[model samples]
Target: MLFSSLLFIFQFLPVFFIIYYLSPIRFRNLILFLASVFFYAWGEPRFVILILISILINYIAGIFIERYDRNEKIRVTILVLSIIYNIGTLMFFKYFNFIIENINYIFKGDISFIDIPLPLGISFYTFQIMSYTIDVYRRDTKAERSYINLGAYLCMFPQLIAGPIVVYTQVSKELRKRSYYLKDIEKGLRIFILGLGSKVLIANNVGGLWDDMAQIGYANISMPLAWLGLLSFSLQIYFDFNGYSLMAIGLGKMLGFDFPQNFNFPYISKSVTEYWRRWHITLSTWFKEYLYIPLGGNRKGKLRTYINLFIVWSVTGLWHGASWNFIFWGIYFFVLLSLEKLFLKKWLEKNVILSRIYTILAILLGWMIFAITELENIKIYFGRLFSFSISEDWIYYLRNYGMILVIGILFSTPFLKKWYDKQANKILCNILLLVIFLLSIAYLVDAAYNPFLYFRF
Candidate 1:
């Protein structure tokens, strides 16, 4: 049930929108919850039951935590249990095989790996539910007495799979009360169309170049070709994930729920610390609130603060996948961020362009790790990136992909929005928007490459 799929566009979404608009205002939450469940179940019917059980467990835990507020120990016990349950389910479904394989490799024991199927969106939805329970226990939000509203909060389909990690507090009020104005619908349509164009017109095309180059593998890569592949991948991931987030936010707008923004031109950041602030803003904030703050945050001494930062980021990386690569990526980031904190801050403060270049290079190198399956291949890729094994075919690929690479880099920054905003007159804007909309549809109909990256997760 990809948001960009033909069935979703023609069938599921249309039917859901019709029913939702026709339903009474009081029953809207119930309708939304049912639709969300249907959305999940349509993809993975067996796992829908598991998710429902999780929802019920967390929902009940939240109630108990609120009810036993006078007994701090009891409240803490319930909260801990709820978190453990959520994380335990996530670990079992997502990481069991990963853990088993690692253990088997480490020791000479032959442990058969369990073939556990990961439920679609379990990582995302589990975090959402845990945030709900924790917020209730921490007094940041009240426990929703209405189960229907709570269900709606948990299962909102827009951000359910590849999320902006919408917190329970952000849309709790919207769950109970929302209005669908014509203005909101219009704005949402514009945002959605822009996101669609980004995917179909730019990201998918650039991703094809990435895939084609990567198939050649790192062994044959010339320096220019290697750099081209890395650059294309960096752009592909940005457009893919950010495009998805835009669609999610736009869909939330159409539904009259104001989901927060996820990205903010992160590639423009002059430091790794700044980049994290701008990129995946929601997830970063969630980690800060739920994980970092609880671990004494920066209140601890400098050394402990660094340790806390590393641990939190390592967990963040592991959360992305149950792989050593992700863990290394986390540590990679931790080292850069720590260096900025400890020594480089003052030096970078005096040299803006140098700082920006350093930050971009670090991020690009980090993404090389994220893109590779194994560390050895990543090392080989880096070696090729620095070597001068230029070939005619590799140069041909680079020249062919050069224009798209430029467009992707431009798109990564804020220039497109600036240009779009500079245009005046409603009629002119609407015409341009219509052109983009038509092009998006045309691309969807004709494009050969349309990979949804987060679908793997």
Candidate 2:
């Protein structure tokens, strides 16, 4: 269920949190483990068995890796097998159909595609579980002994389906021992309200324009309209994902756990490199720690470093979806990042206004590539973005969505945050939070169909 939905906010969360708070501290993790499984099953009943089995496999794998620590060959072998199982599971469920279409195109064979659903949160929980076993193998952290503790850590509902991707090490302590605090709940609820506003009030409103453009047809849009639509999408995606991340974090805090920050006002960035550093902070960190650093990172020669970046970006794109467009999106960023690394960074830093403009344009174009899945449609959309065609249609759209768009852009920066920070402890601030919460609830009552953009991944 969507975190933004009235049903989740009104029914599921209230009941879950009440039961959670009443449970004994010793029983909390077990309660969470069971609740999370039920939460997943509420939406994806068919995948419950799949996730349970995957969790069991990883739980066993971690123990084995830790057990054979003194024997290099055995531990290494076990680690490799675990990696294969996790990656293989991801491949079969997420990419098997993607791979099939390509093979058919190449060999002209009429191979039937598998009719299987990608298990809910498989991408997220899989990575989290791998981090556990890999850390055990590297002796960075101990393998969790309690099956309930391990399961709860991996299945924590707050960030399970959509995540800032809380690494095992980040929450290992909390999984074993944590205390409830009223202050924490208060702060976390306010943060949750803020995220609720962002998603329901901002992202949902701005996303309508992009949906309109899609319904109208890409080729028919004027150049100005095209850019405006993409701008709406750029804002939509950032708020949609960012809003969810904030909710996840807020929930974590409420549960007496502190998840890492996942965003840093990426839109304000003046360079693509800076943007990547800010956007999806956790994912970037994950790749850097697990993938890039292992491939020697920048410690390698210049060519090797570039090659490592290429591999990371390619995989990063594929991680988002089982589509060629996603791969292109990754490559697009790779080229921009490579150019910035080569020479653009220095030049861009010299002029703030021009640099931000350049970065914004680059990001909007990238969003265009990301939003459209079909290559031919992507090509048409790109053509429209630069077509220089003129129309009054864009004026109407801007009139309709201009305020939310403005709020989205302003909110994308630290402006609201700065103001909020200044008045955080004041009574007015408390009232404002209440108003935001109430208004967000009201919005959901009328419009409860919000869909998470990253749900596909």
Candidate 3:
């Protein structure tokens, strides 16, 4: 269930955390594992079995890899097979229909596309599973002896669906030994409340403006409104995903597991390369560690480095979805990042304001590509964005959404966060947190547009 949903916030989470806190230390891992399975099953019951397959396959593979460590060939073979299994299952469920449709279009063949359902969080949890096996293969970490501990690590509900993409190493120790503290619970609750405000108060409210533009038709929108609408979406996606990440981190904190930071005020970045460093950080770390470095990261040569980037970006694009637009989005960034690496880096670094403008504009256009799936609609939208057309229609939306947009813009940087930190322990700040919590709950009570955007990925 969605973390923001009233049912999850009020019912499932409360009941589960109560059981979790009351459970004895020895049985905690088992309780967490079972609760996680139930959580996943609540939304995708059939897929739970498939995910169980993943857990067992990887878990067993880790053990075998560790067991056969003296035999390089055997260990390597197990690792390769496990990788193939994880990637193969991900491809079949996520991209089978995507591949079939493309094939039908190209070859004039009527291949009836099977109705396949993607398992919930397959993209996320699969990466975590593969990381564990690969680390064991690399001797970076030992394979866990306890099946229940591994199960809980893989299935923990907090970062299970949308993640900071916690690697197995990050939580292996916590699985083996962890302690609960009242301070951790209070701090986690506070962080969660702020994230709720970010998603519900700011992201959801501004997101409606974009939806309105879509319904109103991009063709009829003036150039100014097109930019505004895209900005709204930019804010919507950032806060939506980042807010979800924060909530996940907070939940992790409460459970005595420290998850990695996912975002770092990416909008403040002056370059796309820097932007990436701050945005979806764990995913970047994953690609860098497992894929890029293995492929010989920049230690090779400039030409090879560019080629390496191309491969990473191509895979990164496909990883987001089984769509050409996502591919284009990846290539778009690849080109920009490549240029920055080649010549523009020096100039962009010196000119902060101009670089930020350039970075944000480039990011917004990239989002435009990401926002639309159909090429024709994408063309029309871009045309509107730059047609230089004038209309007073934008004024109406600006009036309606201006304040939330301002709030989103401010929060996207570190300004609000720094200010909050400065006043963190003050009575006013505490009251503000309470008000945010109460308002978020009220919004969820009557919520309309509360979808967590990254769940599809």
Q: Please give the ranking of all candidate structures by lDDT, highest first, separated by commas.
A: 3, 2, 1
Query: Runs in model 2 with CA error above 4 Å?
Result: none
Residues 1-457, candidate 1, lDDT per residue (tens digit)? 8776667777998899899888898988898889999998898888988878887888899899999989999999999999899999998999999988988888977899887888888888888999999999989998888777888888888888889899899998888788889889888877877777777677887887668766887787788778778788888888888888888888899899999899999999989999999988988999999899999899989988998999998998888888888889999999998999999978888999999999888988988888886889888988988888877666787678889888889888888788777773368888987897787777777765677787666
lDDT of 2 by residue, 34-128 (tens): 99998899999998888888788888988998887789999988889889999999999999999999999999989999897888878888888
Top lDDT hit: 3
Q: Which scores greater on lDDT, model 1 or model 2?
A: 2
Q: Give lDDT per model, in order.
A: 0.85, 0.91, 0.92
> Which should have the higher lDDT, number 2 or number 3?
3
- TM-scores of all predicted structures: 0.97, 0.98, 0.98
Give Cα distance to truth, residue 34, candidate 3, Å: 0.9
Regions of model 3 farther than 4 Å from truth: none
State the weakest 10-residue window (summed lDDT) of model 1. Answer: 419-428
